[model samples]
Target: MTTAFDTAARPAAVPGDTLVLAGRPLRDHAVLEETSRYAEDVWVLTPAWLRADQKTLRLDFTLVPPALVDVAKPLFLALLAQDTPPGELPLAIDSIRTYFGCARRFLWWVHGRDRTLRELDGEDLDDYHREITALRLSGGATRCNRRAVRMFWAYRNVLPDHLGQDPLRRSLWQAWARVHRRAGGENLTDRIPEQVVAPLLSWAMRWVDDFADDVLAARAERDRHRGPAARGP
Candidate 1:
């Protein structure tokens, strides 16, 4: 019901005279550079995010999509206000922020390099996937990249389900790159060796077991007047 960042969002408002916009008058490059930091601060205040580390703060700001950044300014500030000062933003809110930031970076290539989403065809998608591979994000961050792509396409589906970490499902993505001209990602066939996979899987299984145990432990106790049954006997 709450509209966090629905309408009003703005970066820190210094005195008008003290604020000096950088880069071209209309480019908004300096504003974006600072805005990225503002976004990072918001990330710091998120409970637990999809990204594993702080590298999201290092995202490229080449294009700074007008649609994304211009509106996001107000959206970002509004989200911060919802978090108040010391409290952390919820996980869903953090995921939304990551999705927005990722798409904003992707649009840089599509918009700044004079490439339209249509050009996602040909060899472009292949090259774009390569760039994503080079991004060096952790397992969780890679998941965020997939989420960004899902949003960029305006799909009603959540990326985690349709485009999970499972390498088997990735093959279907080629159609997206081809049809939307939005190139696909690097082949993850052997991207993650078993050495890494085994441990993650083990840890996840253990956590699931721990969760089930807690559920059992929380089972409610029923109190009754058994003395009445004994008197009847």
Candidate 2:
């Protein structure tokens, strides 16, 4: 299981049962030094119990690398912070972070230097995808990375004068759309009919929800067992 505090560690908020840690720059977080170039900040969230004792605490953090934040903080804020419904921010953030991280790594692999999103052309994108394909990433991972690249370009194109001046951008967009619509292993969801996919999703969601509820119940039960004296003054 992916736990909290995978990268940086710092204290944050005490919102209800969830503790939201502040974002710490990658340079200061040693645990993330190797991956820091890809991220901007790390947000750590955990159940209150896990944080009650420092010595035994285990942290799992949400990484917001520079690749995602440097160029698109506003976009993420609008989509993840403002639009996401309550109790779902984690999922939204995770999706955004994963996609952005992959996109940044792909770009870094191709360019090997700092470059604006506007400067990249379709060839850069095609090369990255080709290299990733050659690496033989798992089907799901490749699809995820492709989607991330698509999302990055989509948002970047929205910038003023970004796409109007460059026809290559349009070609790249069209190429990805063709890939996206095609029937293949990389597009499993596309291959599956909605009727078949819906129940599978519903079942999976229910299982996750039940598992979370059980874990919370067990934690509460453990606290109750502690009693007033065991909890200390």
Candidate 3:
């Protein structure tokens, strides 16, 4: 029943106990202050700003099957801790939530089949890919799910229980990606016509060139009119 926060295996604080978070030196206390494990299966992560609408980014592992939860928790905890080596970065809360969705979908699929994650082989992955393809999900959605499955292999060294082999090492994946338009595909976003873009750019330039100075001056004047107490530090 040991949670991430109470785990004895948690890494000891490094020298100076400093973390470079959001381009600033964040002390250990500041990082822990924003993260809390409310239960064995739920973690609430708050960003520094703590916006009202996004007060917490909750990762609830209870949605994962009980048999698989032990294996899943460590992977997520490592990700939440941002334990990557140099040149790698931790995912933002929003990105982590997206990954969680992908992971949850895959875990539920495995659970439905009465399979354990550790027992998943490359063939099992291929069948899973076929299942995902059968769903007719958009190319992006399929890729996200595929990437989540591959994550178990990619981060295997960090996880106590992980896939024994690379899921993407097989040639079948390349064939699947090509056949499904999942690889080397151009962005499908509709480009705004030049006719529409030209007017928007012109209006933006006019605001910057003709109106920005006046707006800044008004703001400065308003700030100046405020008493020192009103502008208290």
Candidate 4:
């Protein structure tokens, strides 16, 4: 499956159906503010997008939240606090922390930092943006924030004003460049302390691979010492 076709010769192409928006920092700008969890936010847009595109091609946005992963920490603790098998905890944490975690952090941040507790609507998200843009998010974190915020607003129910209805959300940037700069801002990915990749795998894949190898080697060595079993015994 890992086949490579010379991409340069194919004439670069950007999908018109794919619209990418930049994410805001969850704690966007302020150091004091924490990050958000946008775990369910991304999927929340599915129905709306389906209604919009219908055919030609399905449209989707892949949000990249730089520092939004910490949101999974609570989920991890939640799992640990439960009665799930200890053996299962590590595997669950691996997926929760690695795959959808950043988006989760973005959601956690906006819910926790930008909007006041118990209040999901009626706030000026733009000010929140200004605030987030000022603080330090880990690499590609800002995009996570902005994308989550926009998607959250897009999915949230709007309140009725005396005159009409207002949008429940806002966007950090209309284009991708600003988003890339803000989220991928600084090499924050590196800022996240390098971890040995194998050390992580050792907990599962490596250990199992090692155990199998040891078992096979032990059997071979025992057979070798037996001198072909000396015919019939």
Stretches off by above 4 angstroms in model 4 are 1-125, 157-172, 175-233
TM-score (C-alpha, index-matched) for candidate 1: 0.33
Q: For residues 77-140, could you state the per-residue lDDT of candidate 3 as single tens digits?
A: 6666676533345665556677888988888888888866678888888888888888998887
Cα lDDT tens digits, model 1, 1-233, are 42343222433442222211121121212242343243332323222222334323322333366533433333333333343222333224344556557666666666656644533553454455557757877655655665455433222111111111222135445543444442357453533533466679888988787676765555532224323354554
Per-residue error for 156 in candidate 3, Å, reads: 1.3
lDDT of each: 0.42, 0.45, 0.65, 0.36
Q: Answer with 1 or 3, whichever has the higher TM-score.
A: 3
Deviation (Å) of 167 in candidate 3: 1.2
Using Cα atoms with residue i matched to residue i, what is each candidate's TM-score against the true structure?
0.33, 0.40, 0.60, 0.26
Q: Could you give the candidate ranking by TM-score, starting with the highest?
A: 3, 2, 1, 4
Tell me the deviation in Å of residue 60 in model 1: 14
Ordered by lDDT, highest first, the candidates read 3, 2, 1, 4
The better candidate by lDDT, 2 or 4, is 2
- Candidate 1: residue pairs that collide: 9-73, 9-74, 10-74, 120-181, 121-181, 125-183
Model 3 vs. true fold: TM: 0.60
> What's the TM for model 4?
0.26
The lowest-lDDT stretch of 10 consecutive residues in candidate 1 is: 155-164
Identify the runs in model 3 with alpha carbons over 4 angstroms from their true place: 1-31, 48-56, 85-89, 179-233
User: Residue 153's C-alpha lDDT in candidate 3?
Assistant: 66
What is the TM-score of candidate 2? 0.40
Model 4 per-residue lDDT tens digits across residues 1-233: 22232111322232233222112111123321122222323322122121223322111123433333232222333332232332222222222233244435445555456443125443445555565668777545665455434433221221110101122223434333344554335463322211344346557775577587897889999988988455675
